[model samples]
Target: MSAPPDQGHVLVWQEPVQEAWIDYNGHLSEPYYVLVFGHATDNVMDAVGIGPDYREANDASLYTVEAHVRYLDEVSAGADLEVRSTVVGATGKLLWIWHEMWVDGRLRATEEILGVHVVGGGSAPFPDDIAARARELLVDPPEEASGRIRPLRRA
Candidate 1:
């Protein structure tokens, strides 16, 4: 499927591995992978204007309902990694995102995330405006992965 015209707005976050993130094998620790992806998700949310302030103003925030990650390569400590994210799809209360982590132009990992907007006071539906904004950022799933689209599998 083709990417959305405003795909340039998709966020890219670059981070370098720290000593603390390294394991005895001299590679990034397993847990750090999730941590890094979490940071990348924050960057994407900020780019779409649904960041901290927006959540406070609207009394709503995005929550990760599920995430599927595939580690393709090892990234050693001190390696610089780039994370690129795109909104694969979005509905009234759900969002599907794809993230790729690359180190020195080589793919290291890929993550498919499912999220939802919930009211700050409770787990309720998001307001109309927030839902509309999310829809605008949604895009068609990649052609090869078209059949993979499905409801999130909560971790």
Candidate 2:
């Protein structure tokens, strides 16, 4: 998919919460949130021409270097989920992405990720065309992007 016409977030992925994703407390589990966000990342890769097809042809792919995820609200099993994603920034070899998960128009979670283009078991610059396309979709990072977990006080 191409960048949104107004340079806003793109609706990158959609899926229902899986039954197995629910935890014992009867809500969507933490790891599953990351899994769904990872799928959104894959969709973003596809949008910028670095998907599985490209990986097969070029022997390269993008790998996440870091990620921060916030679970804003509880989600029940079988909820219809929609993920909106933005290319917050891009360079020759790196991409910064932001993703929001919405259920019935309510924000449930958010994720920010940094990824690097990798080839031959090491980081590498993206092909010119792919880099240009990624840059074309770039938008300003969200206010909450790049946040870190708070440290705990010693007892």
Candidate 3:
């Protein structure tokens, strides 16, 4: 899965919405969204050669420094979900990724993530090969995360 076959293409990862992930209201739970996005994240990581092999060989790993998610719609159990990720930005030590969650051809959610490469305990630059491969997949860096201010809605 190193860097995927097509770096410029969307990395689509698909999975079913699990029944155990449903909440009392019968929709996907808050935490499960994070977990599914994480599955996509792991796919991206493996693609960029930062997986278990890298961890074992280089003694380096990634840590989620920050993340932002917007829940736009509900996802029910038994629905098939697709999470597509595009690398939006990256540096020697940091990777910025944006993900869209699709259900039935409709966009259901979005997640933006920032991960830092860690060697030992502190952040360190990514390996040259990894960095170069990721650069090929880069997109326009997103705007800085702004604190959201929710407006009143119809009740």
Candidate 3 residue 3 Cα shift, in angstroms, is: 12
Q: Rank the candidates by lDDT, best first.
A: 2, 3, 1
- Number of the top-ranking candidate, with TM-score as the measure: 2
User: Model 3 residue 35 lDDT?
Assistant: 93
Show pairs that collide, candidate 1. 1-143
For each candidate, what is the lDDT?
0.73, 0.81, 0.79
* TM-scores for the candidates: 0.82, 0.88, 0.86
Off by over 4 Å in 3: 1-7, 141-155
Model 2 / residue 109 / CA error / Å: 0.7
* TM-score of model number 2: 0.88
Query: Residue pairs in steric clash, candidate 2?
Result: none
Give RMSD to native, each candidate: 5.4, 6.6, 7.2
Model 1 spans > 4 angstroms off: 1-9, 143-148, 151-155
Please give, for residues 29-127, the per-residue lDDT of candidate 2 as tens digits: 999999989888888898888989899988899999888998999999879888899887777788888899989999999998888899978999999
Give the candidates in order of TM-score, highest first: 2, 3, 1
lDDT per residue, candidate 1, 60-150, as tens digits? 7779887888888999878987887877777667777788888998989878787787776556654666666666666655543324555
Model 2 lDDT on a 0 to 1 scale: 0.81
Stretches > 4 Å off in candidate 2: 1-9, 147-155
